[model samples]
Each structure stands twice: as structure tokens, then as C-alpha cells.
Target: MSSPLFTSVHVGGRQATHRVVMAPMTRARSTQPGDVPNAMNARYYSQRASAALIVTEATQVSPQGKGYSFTPGIYSPEQIAGWRLVTEAVHAEGGRIFAQLWHVGRMSHADFHNGDLPVAPSAVAFEGKIWKVDPATGKGEMVDCPTPRALDRDEIRDIVSDFRRAARNAIDAGFDGVEIHGANGYLVDQFLRTTSNVRTDEYGGSRENRLRFLKELVCEVAAEVGANRTAIRLAPFLTARGMACPDILPTILEAVEFLEAQQVAYVHLVEADWDDAPQFTEEFRRQVRARFRGTIIVAGNYDVERANWVLQHGYADLVAFGRPFVANPDLPARLAQGLPIADFDPATLFGGQDHGYTDYSPMQQAA
Candidate 1:
């Protein structure tokens, strides 16, 4: 019998031929000035169309949602047209893709905001940094993040509207569905932790209050795009970027319950994959499985052996490979046939031309 990893699965009411998914990664190669996707981006995605599901890089929903330089946006007409090329390219290859809507919140630098402070749930200091480019040198580097201002009640509502609008734009651009970026110490993750969000208002303090922003954002996006087409990514064990919260696990369970109620498509769980990172308990996995009946995507440092292990045990419906997909476009086929997986060039991973992007060929061409 074949490995369970090769088995077909249903995700968001759509049939995926296999269980290997391409996790979203920040490439920072969008067209400058307008921060739009382009033909090169389309080619890069099309080359990796063999994956069961492709979650595009974290795309900012609005200008205020951007953090790093050169990341793509979905709020403008040109951006929508640019993304259309990507969707068309992937669809032409018979592959499914979802746009990951993102908001960086306080994880931003003032250079992108015209000297204004990045907004968050509270003005708390975040020991975080963002990738920025020096205009004079035209090279990107990690820069420290300054303390951000708290978002007003009305401003919070506006951000939620931005997410809903972004979802609509994704569909208009021919995307199969949309996934909200709620992990990796971004805007939504900031609101979920007490260390980052200490507000006494309706959006902070208690676990329920802290979940209010996520609930509203998810509800609004699902309303614009059907709940069956809406998805979210969450990280429960993430402790970096000043985001360690004692009550986070229970809070995430509550959020999972709400997602089940909304009938959302899937929940993408990002495990802490760094060296010495905390382990994701199997008990928590069982709890989440009991709460949500939809698809569960688990992403971390996973290889073929680990991927099949999770599938055989029913811990996840799909496994997402991040760096592996970068170097091996035909990752599913390579794994299926036991072909050699190539190593990616770290220097050219982001903000570059096709050297390390579309230049990576399939096994036939490589051989």
C-alpha cells in the first residue's frame, strides 16, 4: 500500500489530489513602488503548482497592514490584476491556491508609515524587528521596532473591514479561497496575548475579550467570502517576538470552538520550529480535533517520515512544507518517487530575481 501522504483529501469543499501543502513564506520580491505581484511572481508559483494546496505569501490587506519592504498588497486595482496572473498560472496547471491576508500591526517600521507609529491593540513595547530596506543602499536588513500606538475602537473596526475587503479582492483576482494571517506575532497574534495586549477594554484582558478582535475579523471575512472558503493560521506555542502568554492555549481552544461554530474551512497551526522550540502536545491536538470538524494543517520542520507519521495517526489532514517547497518545485512527486531534495540558496531567498526562485527546476530537468 502507498503511504497515507499520497492519499487524496478534501479541503474547504474542494478535492486536493494529495496531502502535501505549500505553506506561505515571505519572499519580498513583489514589484517595487506599487508593491504588486508580477509575471515573475506568477512563474514562481506556477512552477510549484504540483502541491495539493498553495498558500501564497503573506499579502498585506491594506497599506497600513504592511511591515516588510517589497511584500505584495491586495487592496489596489493594479495589485488585483497582478495577482490575477498568479491565480491564472496556478489554475492553468490544475493546482489550487489560497491568498493569505495579512496585517502586521505593531510589527512594522515607521518608514512604511510616513513617520507615524505602527498601531496595535496597546502601546506596549514589543522587542521585535522587521525587515526594511535602506533607500540609499537598496538592500534589506532587520531593524528594531519602536513602540506602537494603540488602535482606537473605530480604528479596530476599520482594520476588520480591510480584511473583509481583502477577501473579496482575493476572489475577484481568481483565488480559490483566502486564509487570514493570525500567526507569527502579527496583528491578530498580538491581540491574543496578555504580554502584548493589556487593554482593559472589550478587546483585551480576559481571554474572551482578547478573542473579540479575531472573532470579528473572521466573522467579517467569512460574511464577505463564504465560511466554507475562509481559513485562518494560528500559532499556540509561539513565544518569540515578545509573545508568551500563560492563558494562550485555553484562549486558542476558545477560538477554535468559535471557528467550528462559524464553519470555517480550516485552521493552519504553526508549530514553534526553532531550535529548542517547545513541543506541540498531542493532547492539545486531540482537543482541537474534537472541537473543529474541518481540515487541520500542521506546519513545522517536517520531512516525509514525519509527514506520514502525522497522517497515519490522524493528527493532521495535511502537512505544509515551507523551505522544502522553495528548493523543490515538484516536492510531492519527488517525495513520492524518493528523489533527492535540493537545498535552497539562503542569500537569494528574498527580494531577488529568478535565480533562486523560478530557476529551481524539476527532477527531470535537474537530472
Candidate 2:
């Protein structure tokens, strides 16, 4: 039987030929010094152009928004020119792509900030290691994050403006749309959770207050780039970044209400992937659909069968395959033909040449 995943769907004005989206996964393969996208990045994305949508890995909106080394940015003219190659390549293969705009916030080290502290919603530490490129060795490695300085109210507005500028820059770089990286305990997620945001100001305290930062950021971004071309990713139960809270679900629903009010293109729900991770109930899915009116996309370790089930059940409009896309560039075809898929090499997953980058071809192509 043909899966519903292979059916066409409309995301905003673009017509996606398949429902399988290649979710954004960061591979630190950009050129150094400027951290710009290059032809190699273009080749990698263009190869996987079969997916209905390709969300580019989390891109830093500004120098201060950067969390790790070698990740691409959309802030500079050079970066925009560089990303043009990737977008053109994807378009050449008839693929749709979106830039996942990111600001790491407290999940950052001081090395990228000229020895200054990283900025966040609060002066809290994330309590884990973040990936950074070694200045001396010029290699990517895990490094501890320092205690971040909280963003002043004025500074908060500036950061939101940065997101708006990034969205405009992304359009110039040839992206079809932009996905605000509000998930994974990043800048916006920090403000959403009570554990990270303990502020008593207008930007924090209550759920609506915590939702202010994200709301303002998305609103400004959508204003700059029409709401039809704007999207946001949210992780309701992800505590890996020490962002666990009791009220996170309600806050997510509240944010969805605003997002629907803005008529955003879609809301990407990132659930836990591992077997040990908590699974959200079907009731939650119904709740999300009730709140958001546009499209709902679901990610986190989804396979063809499970993705088909959700799409058939009217829970999600699209299914994003992360690691599978990492390994199988022809992921949609592989699912359609029920062909054997390859497993990715984790060691070469980040900061590598062509070994694990673009070398992985389809089973037929390899044979």
C-alpha cells in the first residue's frame, strides 16, 4: 500500500510533492573564519532534495547568537551569498527549503563572544557541555557553558529585532521560508520554561509573560517575512537541556493560540525520540490540532509506519525524519519502495569532509 506520506501537500504557497520533510540537523561543515555556507553544503542538501521540505540546520541570527563553531549564519552578506549556493542547489533539484533561524542564548561558551559572557533570559547555567571548535587545534569538541548574563529589557527588544533581520536575510539567501528555533532550550525556549526564566518583569513570571518573548519575536519576524512564510518549532517534553517544568504543556498551547492568531504556516512539534523518553498521549495531539489551525508537523524519531499512522489520523500534516535523512539522501524514495536504508556514522556526523557528509548515496546508486 502506498503511504499517505508520499502524497502532495501545500505548505504555505509551495506545493510539496511528498509529506516527508528532511528536518534540520546541524553538521559543522561550514568554512571557518566567516562561518559561511559553501558548495559542499550545497551538494549535501541538494542530494537530499527529494524530501518535501528541507529545513536547514539551526543558523545563528547574529555573532552573539552563535553557540557553536563553524555553524552557518544568515547575518552577513557573505553568509547570504554562501547560502545562496545551497538554496539554488536544492531548487535545482525541485526541493523546498527553509532556514531554521537560531539563537543559542545561555547554551553557549564565552569564546565566541570575545571573552564576554553569553546572554540569556536569566543569569542561569545550562549545566552541560556544548559543541565548540577549538581555537588551537581547530577541531570541534564539547565544551562547558558558562553562566550567562540575563538580557536587559531593552536588550531583549534588540535580540527580537535580530530575529526579524535574520528572517529577512534568509529570504535574501533564497530560502522559501524561515523556522524560528524556539525549541531545544535555546533562547526562546529559555524564556518559555519557568526553570530557566525566573524573572518578575513583563517578559516573565506568568505563562503569558513567558510567551511574550517568543510572541514578539515571531510577530516581528512574521511582519518582516509574511506569516505565511514564517514557522516555529516547539518541544513540549524535552528536558535534555534542563528545561523540564510542570506548566510547559500549557505554555506551548498558549503559544500555539497566538501562532494561529498570526496564521503562521505551521507549528513543528518535537517529541522525544529515544525509547526511554516520555511519550505524549494522543489527547495532546488532539489538543494541539484544536489550538493551531494551519498545519501541524511532527518530528523526533518517526519512521514510515508511525508517520503514516499520524498523518492518517489527522494529527500531523507532515512528518520529519531526522537521522534517516542524515543517512539516506533519497529518503522519500526509500520509504516509497521499501528499500533498505543505511545507518549514519556518528563519529563523522559533525565537522567532517565528504566521508559522512555527501558520500552516502542511495542503495541503488551505491550498487
Candidate 3:
């Protein structure tokens, strides 16, 4: 018998060839001035088309949603055309792809906002940093994030609209579906935690109220794109960047129930990967499985054995590999044939040309 990881599965209303997914990573290699995807971006994604599904790097929904320099966007005509290149390339190679709609919220620098503060659910400061490139030297560096202003009620509504438009744009650009970037302590994650969100209106004060933003955002996106085609990524166990909340687990359980109600395609759970990170209790996994009937994809420091463990035990339907897929484009075939995997160059991981991106050869070429 073959490993269950090699079997086909239904995800986001499409049939994926296998259970190995390509988790989205920030490459910061979009074209300058317009922050648009380019032919090089298309080639990079096409190379990894062997994954069951490819979630493109977090593409900002709006200009203000941008946090890192050179990340692509989906809100403009140029960006949509640029992403079309990527979707076409991936499809031509017989692969499926989804665009990750994102808004950085307070995880941004004023350099992105023209001296204005980044907006969040509350006017709070966290010990967080964002990646930025110095214009003079053109080198990426991590910089401190200043305190951000709270969004007015109307601005919050506007952001929800931004997500909706981005989803529509993704479909227009020929993606199979769209995944909301709700994990990784970004805008959506910020609203879910008490330490980051201190709003006093209907948007906050209670867990239900805190969840209102996410509920609204999901509902609107699902309405624009069919619920069967809409998906979300959530990090229930994340506590980094001043985001530790005592009530977060129960709150995430509540969010899962709402997602089930909405009938969204899948829930991508990002487990803590660092050595000292808290354990994602199997008990919690059981709880989530009971609540949501949709597909569940898990990503962390997963090896072949661990990936099979989750699938065999029914904890997840698919496993996503980030760095592994970067160095090994034909990751599925390599795993199936037991070929040697290559190591990626961390220095060229971000904001670079094809040297460490599309230049990584498949096993046949390497051999």
C-alpha cells in the first residue's frame, strides 16, 4: 500500500492530485514601483506546480494593507494582470493555485503609509517588527513597528470591502479559489486577541464582539466568492509578538463554529514551529474536527512521518511544506521515489532574482 499522502483529495471544491500543499511564503520579489507580480514570479510558482495546491505568497488586498516591501497586490489592474501570469503558468503545468488575500494592519511601518500610522482594531503598540528595504542601499532589514491608530467603525467596514474586492480580483486573475490571510499575527489575528485589540464598541470588549470583525469579513468574502471556494488560515496556538491571550483557544473554537456555519472550503491551521512553542494539544484538534466538516490543512515543521501521522489519524486532510518545496520543486515525486532533498540558500530567500528561486533544479536535472 502507498502512503495516504500520495492519494487524491477534494479541497476548496477542486480535486488535488496529492496531500502535499505548498504553504505561502514571503519572497519579496515583486516588481518595483507597482508592487506587481512578474514573469519571474510566474516561473517560480510553475516550478512548484507539483504540489497538490500552491498558496501564493501573501498578497496585500490594498496599498495600506502592505507590510513588507516588494510583496505583490491584487487590487490594481497591473497586479491582476501580473497574477494572471502566475495562474496561467501553474495551470499550464497541470496544478491548482489559490491567492492569499492579506491585510497587515498594525504590523506595518509608516513608510508604507506616507507618515500616517498603520490602523488596527485598537490604538495599541506591540513589540513587533516589519521587514523593510532602505531605498538608498536597497537592503532588507527588520525595523521596529510604531504604535498604530485605531480604525474608525467606517474604516473597518471599508477593510472588509477591501477583502471582498481582493477575492473577486483573485478569481478574475484565474485562480482556482481564494484564501483569507487570517493567521500569522496579521490584521485578522490581531483582532482575535485581547492584548492587541482594545476597542470599546461592537467590535470589541467580549469574545463574540472581538470575533465580529472576522465573522463579517468571512461572510462578505464568502458572499462574493462562493463559500465552497472561500478558505481561511488561522493560528490557534500562536502566542508570539505580544499576542498571548488567555481566552484565545475558546475564541478560536467559536470562530471554527462560525466557519462551519458559513460552509467555507477549508481551515488552514498554522501550528507553532519554534522549539519552545506550546504544544497543539490533540484534544484541541479533536474539538476542531467535531466543529468543522470542511477540509483541514496543517502546516508546521512536518516531516514525512509526521505528515502521514496527521492524515492517518484524521487530524488533517493535507500537509503544507514551506522551505522544503522551495529547494525541491518536484517534492511530491522526490518523496515518492525517496530521492535526496536539497537545502535552500537562506540569504537569497527574499528580494532576489532567480538564483535561489527558479534556479533550484529538480532531481533529474540535479543528478
Q: Rank the candidates by TM-score, best first.
A: 1, 3, 2
For each candidate, what TM-score against the reference?
0.99, 0.98, 0.98
- Candidate 2 residue pairs in backbone clash: none
The candidate 3 region of ten consecutive residues with least summed lDDT is 10-19
Task: Compose the digit string of candidate 1's lDDT tens values, residues 234-313.
Answer: 99999999998998999999999999999898999999999998899999999998898888999999998999988888
Ordering by lDDT? 1, 3, 2
Clashing pairs in 3: none
Q: Against the unseen true structure, what C-alpha lDDT does each candidate score?
A: 0.94, 0.90, 0.92
**Residue lDDT tens for model 2, 20-55:** 998989998999789899999999999999888899
Q: What is the lDDT of candidate 1?
A: 0.94
Local error of candidate 1 at residue 86 (angstroms): 0.3
Clashes of 3: 0
User: How many steric overlaps does candidate 2 have?
Assistant: 0
